[model samples]
Target: MKNKLSKLYKIFLAVGMVFSMCFNTLGMSVVNAYDPSVPKEFTRVKNIKYPEWWGRKIPSIASWSTYSCKYDGKWAFCLEAEKKTPASGKYPAQVIENNENVRKLLYYGFGGPAAYGEFAADADLKTAICPDDPLTNDDIKYLLTHIFLSGAYSGQWKGFDENLFNQTFGSNYGTNIMNIYRRIISLPDPGNGVSWEGNKSGNRALFKASYDKTNKQQVTNTVKLNGASSAEVNIPLASNVTIHIAGTSATQTGGTAKVYGGQSFYFTAPCQNSPSNFVSDNICGNGCERFTALAIHDGGAGTQAQGTWNMDPDDARLYLNIE
Candidate 1:
């Protein structure tokens, strides 16, 4: 169920700022400390590992459908009126900047470095594609889906998840968001013992961690949850897995969930946030629009098995189903 927006939430909406995020009951806050010396340009982002297939071929946009973005740049498709509002723009640039999948879509849409005849190392797609205005959730949805459809049409996204796309989008332009999701997960295994992929179904965002026994077992990662209402973490293997939701400073509306290797744990909003509702749902007392950092791992049992969590975005670990 949706929670009422508090007055403070409305105020933050007006000024375009995030309220200070406090920890949940778990008493932990995952902070991205800002560094002033690093250049703000997209090219300056360091240590990102793009999929091997990136920049391999530049997609032809000649036949791709187009739309006029309010920011003066032309995008691939137009969004429904409700989703194109200025409010949508408030959904955090910091989140998008840190996402590897979003970055890939950006570079690919700009025709890759090869298209410019410059070496891959020198290509700066951000300067060319990232708009000066703050990016809205819809802006991301439009761009990613547009590029995805064009790529699919051009036969670039081979073995595409047709059923998944049809089930999620199903002849609706407004819902054609995050088409890059399935593609990202489907990429060749990262060979890291565990591979991560995420998808969206209705109101829930689904996350899958596939483990390869040859590499390693029991992978743990920090996950950031955006707009979550509730979540379910399922550890199908016979190991002890623990999921913790770090709480807010004032309320401590956070806790932990655990499953004995073959069970699932679930919780609701405030103590939760659901994927699609991140931008619209406001439960944080300071009107911060609560984003949770979830830490998940099998307590070093070294079990080679798959795990699933229905949640939202960060790095490549989460995919925000910002419908």
Candidate 2:
């Protein structure tokens, strides 16, 4: 549900980092490794098709909203922005726009020089806006797609179901912090026909992808849960999805639905290929697998069932209800 924090994503996804991540109770970044032989930046991350988007931060302006279901809920935010076009339409914009490769980064989370109609050239980066620049769209698109290597804890993020996480963190997990981000280093995809994206090399890396905010190009969405699962979610290209908690969702705590809290988790829903709004009611209807998974007891504070999110300042809860 949260993608902007690209750097933070690497920590949660890469099982190895679970052992080396230098973090505090607050989940902030701390320098853990000090090997000069290793490059501060990633060179060749494995698993992912293009090891370009390994360690980069993508910027976004999300409109905030909240929703909840019985026993679990969500209080996450999202951004639906269009290409911010400048009058010039030359140089970076035109250069990036003219390059069909540039549009690839805008569509999918990953972008490279030629994949998906996007491109990034290797220049001296004399005026490059990167990592976290707050000016200019040129810097915005270029920096957003290029993933950079990071140590760990620089940001907050959700950790998913990986054995490395449990062995390394030792019962400490959760994405309850704000300003969280995820960066990809080297994580390998599964060797199945499903076609997954990952880079599992020992170093952090980034790809050269760009997006012309000026074009306002949109990303399409779709959703489909395989086999018999508790729930199904659908993501949209733009913004207009909502998850309601008070309506018809809750936990055995029947008193009233409250979000369950738990460790960091990943939720991936397909982007809609056509124009249609997918919706869900009640928690996953069945033996309660859905409720058990997202119950606040796990530290999530919201049931993954109803797609509701209830986050307050005291604690950061991500009620990511999409698809």
lDDT of each: 0.28, 0.22
- Scored by lDDT, the top model is 1
What shift in Å separates residue 298 of candidate 1 from its native position after superposition? 36
lDDT tens string, model 2, 1-323? 22233554455557545644644445775342222222122111111111111112111212211111121111111011111111111111011113222122222212221212112343322132222333333232232332210112111112222343334334422121111113121221111011101221221111111222554322222212222222222222223222222233421211222221111112222233322322223322221121100101111223111111111221111112222
- lDDT for residue 269 in candidate 2, whole number 0-100: 24
lDDT of 1 by residue, 112-182 (tens): 21111111334432332333434433433444444453343233432233454455335632233233344
Tell me the TM-score of model 1. Answer: 0.18
Model 2's lDDT to the true fold?
A: 0.22
Give the least accurate 10-residue stretch of model 2, judged by summed lDDT.
85-94
